[model samples]
Target chain A: MEKLFYFSDLFGVAVFSITGALMAGRKSMDLFGVLVIAVITALGGGTLRDAILDNHPVAWIRDDTYILVATLAAVGTVLWVRLTRPINETGLLVADAFGLAVFTVIGTEIALQHDTPVSAAVIMGVMTGVAGGVMRDVLCNEIPMIFQKEIYATACIAGSLVFIGLLELGVAAWIATCLSMATVLLARLAAIRWRLSLPRFHLLDRI
Target chain B: MEKLFYFSDLFGVAVFSITGALMAGRKSMDLFGVLVIAVITALGGGTLRDAILDNHPVAWIRDDTYILVATLAAVGTVLWVRLTRPINETGLLVADAFGLAVFTVIGTEIALQHDTPVSAAVIMGVMTGVAGGVMRDVLCNEIPMIFQKEIYATACIAGSLVFIGLLELGVAAWIATCLSMATVLLARLAAIRWRLSLPRFHLLDRI
Candidate 1:
């Protein structure tokens, strides 16, 4: 189970690093900026999770492999973009959604392992899923996607609940994880394809 | 002692909020963005402090006054900027240094109150002092000052050590706190004026 979990984490890290590099590339940032974003995108979620859980030494600090993978992924992304002029934004978004789905479930599982309450686990899962991308956006000098026009965090929340429900029903951990990922991925892609958006509450406008 | 400590916290929050609003104004962000940065800058240190200590109901969540003050500070800054054209960036940076100095001491004091080790307290203090600015930078889409050039976190770390040293010498808390704050402020300003930067390890390139 632990081995499977580690593999899943590696997969998520690679996908997220690619997304980060692609986002930074869109802004025509320097190589250093691209690598910084990639590192943040890959490690930001797990860092938050460990910090909140008081699981000290953070995940990346504990193992250097995550950083290694993210660096490779980032270099690979830059090379791919250089080779193929005009990177595909939509394809990167899709990859990001898939990464988000896997990360959310994995984060929830880790929180659960730490004996956090179900509600806290769910929230942590959503936070872990979206924080990386949010950090990437923030570093890239753009409004976070969470506060913008996509059901990003909402989908993570929904998928987390699905994972919890499956656990309650005695489903195997791997199966539940897969279902949760699929739900978030499908929801995100559908939202993107159909242009779905939550209502913006402009409390500032009224004041 | 408690009264002085509380006063310092209030002063720090107000000054930090002003600094945040000033940065937002420099970037020509809207009122909402300005307010967001102000709140984050004001509450950021305490939030990280409480989180590291694993305290429940985070400091800002428990005390509404902090949030209220930050909000008012942001509003006041917006009005001031609108009525009075461009503000002095140099002046704002000085205020930020003072804010960072005060918050570093306050954060260390809180950690000590929680019975944390002196080393942990020092680290927590530096984290508190720097985390808010880092978050603000992330939100505004700029490289965190700590990660780039500046004596930002270094100043906080030095101050925290001084604070701990003074406390160990049976120095009065108020005197120690004031001295520590002054240390951080002077060090930070000097670094900024001199364009100080730590050696960036090119270990990543080797990887």
Candidate 2:
């Protein structure tokens, strides 16, 4: 179970790094800018989650492997895109959905281990899933994609709730993790495919 | 000494919150958005610092005072703006500069207490000074003002170095902190007054 979690975390980092690199390329950022944004996009979420939960030595700082993986993935993506055709937008979204699902489950489990309140656990999970992308968008001078009507954060919240619920019902850790990941992945993919979205909170409309 | 630090911390929070609220107003964000940005601006830097330093139970989470101060400041700014003319840009920048100075010194002190290396301590100090403003700009969907050719971060780095130097010279803790804060404040103010800036990193030109 531990090994599986570690591998998935790295996988998520790699995918997020690739997305960040692609975004940087679109902006025509310099190589240094590309690398910085990529690393931040991959590590920002987990860093926030650990800090909120009082987990020490932030993941990338503690285990050099996380940094190495993110940096390499970012560089590789830049090179691949240059050599080949640009990755399709749809493909990028699909990879991002998978990364979000894995990160949400991992964040929730970590929060639970810290014995945080369920509400806080769910919040942490959603933050872990989405914060990095939000950071990336902000750095790129765009409104965060999550704040759109898209079902992104909602999917993370739902999966986190499912994971906690299954655990309370005595489900095995591995089973709960897998089921929750599927829930998020399916919701996100459906949203992408069908343009599903929650109603936006437009305060101006009411005022 | 501790009491002084605590009061300064709250003052910094209040100033940063006001800056955030004003920025949110300029962006035409809703009241809720204003509050969210204000709180993040006031507390985000300290939160990151604590998390990075392995300080458990983060200061704001450990004490309700920080949140209370931030909320009150945000709401107060909204009310004040409604009752009066918009704050002048220069006034806003001056207040932000003071907040930056205070936060930088406090961050350095906390890092020193944690026995961090000088380089890490310097980085932490700068982060604490500028991160809240960076977050505010990001949320407002603007490129961070710090990245402008401004002397903002340079001031923080210089003050952090001064603080450490004074401490090494066996200066009183209070003296070192006060001098450091003054150094940052003066440097920032001078930059604002004179339009001082560092050289821009024009990667495109180099390429």
Candidate 3:
């Protein structure tokens, strides 16, 4: 069970790293910059979650796999972009949403392990799902996706709630995880496909 | 001695929160946004530091004063801005630098407590000093001050090294801290006064 969870986490890291490399490439960041954003985008939110929960040494520092996966993914993305046709935007969205869903479940479970209250646990899950991309976008000098009327964080929140609700109803851990991840992934896909988004709050209109 | 340090830490939090609020005002963010940015600007770096070090319960969570000071600072800045004339930019710089210098020393000491090596400690110190402001500027969708040609992070690094070096020489802790903070503050002020800056790295030209 632990092995399976670890594999899913690495998969999340890999896909997010690729998305990060894409952003870095678009920004004309050097190879080093590309790698830095890759690591941050893949690890930033989980790192934040662990830190906020006071989980020691952070996952990446304690285990080298996360960094290795992120690096390989980043390098691969850079090479692929240079050698092949441009990446399809839809493909990137699917990969990104998959990563987000995986991260949300992982974050919620970690929060629960630390005995955080249910509300805070769900918040941590969303933070875990959204913060890495937010950090990546910020580093690229763009608005964070969570603050941009995107359906991203909301999907994570809904999924986390479902995960916790199921656990309370005696669902098996793996089953709960899969269902919750599906919830987030499907919601995000629908949002992307239908151009659905929450209303953006803007003070500029009044001013 | 510990009480004095706590007071200074809170002072840093207060000043930085004010700077954050001022930035929020300029960006036309709503009141909630103003408070959020203020808290992040004041506490974000130290929170990152403690989390990285695996220091549990984080400083702010251990005590309520930091949040209280930050909130008061943010609310006060907003009121001051709306009720009085605009904040003097020079004054803001002084206050911001004060927070940065103090935070650098505090972060360095904490890293040493965790037994990090000298080089890593200096890096941690710089992260503590500059990260909050960097987060603030990024949230405002602007280039971070440290990443610009500014001497900000350099000043923090220099000061942190000084702090550690003096401590290794058997200097009293308080004196080492005061001298180090003075070093950063003075260096930053000089950079501001003389308009000293480093050359920026631009890949666009080479590419």
Selected candidate, larger DockQ, 2 vs 3: 3
Task: Evaluate candidate 2 and give its CAPRI docking class based on DockQ.
Answer: incorrect
For all predicted structures, in order, the TM-scores are 0.59, 0.61, 0.61
Candidate 2 ranges with C-alpha deviation above 4 Å:
A1-47, A56-141, A146-207, B82-85, B199-206
Q: Chain B TM-score per candidate, please.
A: 0.89, 0.94, 0.95
Candidate 1: which pairs clash? none
User: How does residue A139 of candidate 1 score in lDDT?
Assistant: 72
Over B90-116, each residue of candidate 3 has an lDDT whose tens digit, in order, gives 987897788888999999998999899
What local distance difference test score does each model get?
A: 0.80, 0.85, 0.85
Candidate 1 lDDT tens digits, A7-83: 87888899899888888988999999999999898889878777766667887788999999999999998998778
What tens-digit string does per-residue lDDT give for candidate 1 at B70-119? 87988887777556545676887898888889888888888888899888
**How close is each model in CA RMSD to the real structure?**
8.6, 6.8, 6.6
Pick by DockQ: 1 or 2, better one: 2
DockQ of each: 0.11, 0.15, 0.17
**Sort by lDDT, best first: what order?**
2, 3, 1
Question: A-chain TM-score per prediction?
Answer: 0.90, 0.95, 0.95
Pairs in steric clash, model 2: none
What is the per-residue lDDT of model 3 for residues A1-207, given as tens digits with 9 covering 90 to 100?
889888888999999999889889989999999999999999999998887988778999999989999999999999988898778889888988888899999999998887766766776798798789888998898866555544777788889999999999999998999999999999999989997776432333222
